[model samples]
Target: MHHDLVDGVPVIWTETPGPLEATLMFGCGLKDETFRTLGVTHLVEHLAMSTLPRLHFDHNASVSLSITDFTCTGRPEQVVDFLARVCAALTALPLERIEQEAGVLAAEGSGVADPVTAELLSIRYGTQGLGLASFNGPGADRIPLDAVRETVARHFHAGNAVLALTGPPPEGLRLPLPPGPRTARAPHPAPRTTRSSWHRADVPGPGLLLSCSLDDQAMLLAAHVLSQRLTDTARHQLGLSYDVDGTAVFVGPGRGERSIQLDVREGQEQRVAELLWHEAVRLATEEPTEAELADEREAAREFLTDPRTADLEVAERAADLLFGETHLDGETKLALQAEVTPAQVREAFAAAMETALLLVPCGVERLTLGRPDGSALPAGGCSERTALPVGSQYRPPLLARARSGAARKVRLVVNADGAWWQDEEGLIHGFPFTEVVGVEVQEGGRMLQGLGNCFVPVASELFAGLGRAIATIDAAVPEALCYPASALRATG
Candidate 1:
């Protein structure tokens, strides 16, 4: 393998005897997008890719929270040529059919369930940079060409990107990209509340999702060992779940999360939940056996050294370069994996439990470790109160859907102060109009969505004067509530 700089961008390549592959990647992604211009990067990528002529090669463009990649696999010259064309397209984006691209993006967004990571990021941070992960990017009707053009000009450049190849470098592999500063990761969102928070995903195969702020390898090994034990207990021994596994993701430097989940039938949620909690507590208290640690280390080594995965490893190295991560070879990584003591792994698990959040099945209740429903928000003590404006309140002959999919009569109380809702469970939810991201109009009514995954739907007729109220509150909301804590702390 060799490293060099081409046209002011870092380029890495390995000489191997096979089909050549190349990837041009950028560090900017959804995290760089503003709340008002969410999905701009994705739209830009789509527009740029749409401009390219078809070539006889495998190619794809992907958008993630922190990176956007354009990769191709084929003959070396062909791949390099394709990438050159891609760079040219990105530089002079054909945003003319942006409306068509937006429609395509909307259809794409609708197919994938909102990632759990986005919600967790929002809860840990806020409706700012990284917290914007919890939101769906720009809607088909909202994103415009200028926004896409600006995002591209700001992010898609030489200094902010990397080029990686699995085979020998090709001749004339020119990346005539504009120079720009490398964008840094979004500042970590400060915690809104003191405790861990839980959210319902309405996903099948419900299980526990945890956001652990632990070091990388430790989190991975701990999750792996715990996953093994839980899988044996839940599936092999008790037959409670058919599958059990754990996944770890790096949310930020030296900070990440591990999610252990189980797929169980309808009747077994509570028992499985109890078993998972028991194992979590046990893992925190006791260390894994030497055999378990050895197995996990071997697994890590295999993943890093496997020849069949050389292309994937090249891609990972390229992405790491963009993100400023230390690049460790297969052997060094294996040694790092081997040096992790059982006690350290146990300590990581124990620490993870301190801020653990559990997602449970809808019917089954009472995970001893989980927070009660709706308790994730601040306890209400409204310092001020205001009644709805005349004719602002209406009792429609029907109900509307909250963000949680629960049915409730749409009752909205809004003033120059803020917005208020009293749910059927007798819990009061409040959002300063400033905190209100946007009001999504639906067939039944208006779903007032807010930060940290909260929503309140008011009947169409009942929210008749809502626009004026929104404007008034929007004007005053800035002064009243600055952060989420302020909004959570004040309401009527």
Candidate 2:
């Protein structure tokens, strides 16, 4: 079921029955100002999530060259409460606060300064307004907070917002929608059209980045075919790892670009570069084998058919909607991929090999070929420590002591006041209680928190028995318990 509320900021609510999960997605078309607002909005979102109560999870946000989104997931029943809190936060968030807004913008600028790829991107798209290094450049440090806040306040008005909901809908959840159909600003036009080409710049080393630009709509299908064919050929035929991947960027209406990058290891630069060029030329000249084309088609079909693969599709669809591009549906995307001939693939590749090429090599002291320095920053840095708090730990209790086949359940009270856990699945689930100690845990990251109560249930009969025994002992002597604490802690 889906419901739309029409009033101010456009909002839509969707409901489905399954596991209790909720996602709030906000979309705004990308612009220099939009990106600036997104940086501030992102920080504001963090502040809201950090301050909200009964929040099982924190919100996550992403900003792209085209759009920005902020999303959060939680229990279905908490949807209304969460939405209310979010709406309140958005409404009350101070855009006039220069210090806070400038801080976020400065941090955003610092993050992009040293990325060589980003520098290359800036150079490639430099002529386009899209090439601006950031929404706010490094000069953001000089922007007064009040001016930044005023800019944010103006940019965040109803005309530029869309609120979308997914998952089982809560009862009587209310949302504010736009007054009517909202029109978005048209995306910047592509530099040129229908010209197939490739160009390369020699870097000081043997690394290579190959990029090809096409119309966004057509490139979507082309990318699917190219990705699948390259992966299969590289891994099975050439004995290479599947880790070689490329990036696809939506440039504008009839234009997008895709690039395949590889870092040549020591002594293999020439061979690898020659092989890559030959492959590109061959792909442009010859048709893929029928069996190979069929396999790629199957991969494309599976990709469109699978829900897990739908995230990128959903994001693209939203982007297209915002940009006024073709309304590409799943069926249309799949049909296009299925019908794409090997000749078309060759033609696309042939054209792409001509436009622009970038090769970069790092770590080597010298090269026979005279190439410009492409290494932007120092090649190595310290690994980021996990966010888990220092000295905190966790240990799963032994469960083999009870009868192996017996069915039992035990509840655990997680006292993770300021700690977090990385489940086996690698998700960083958090618990904010300072001293919660009684809770039931279900499978996965699901748990219930009561007043001074948080429960995790264990179902392995033996483990359940052990937990039960521990619960009893702890009940009798509460301070004698010893166990590994949570691993997540805040760090500077």
Whole-model lDDT values for every prediction: 0.66, 0.43
Give a tens-digit lDDT track for model 1, residues 271-386.
88678766776777889888999998988877877787777777778877887877766776677777889898888777676666555556664444533222332211211233
RMSD of each: 6.7, 20.2
Task: Write the residue-wise lDDT of candidate 2 on 450-481 in tens digits.
Answer: 11111222233313333443343334322312
Clashes (N, CA, C under 3 Å) per candidate:
0, 41
Tell me the deviation in Å of residue 423 in model 1: 2.0
What TM-score do all the candidates reach, one by one? 0.82, 0.57
**Per-residue lDDT for 379 in model 1?**
19
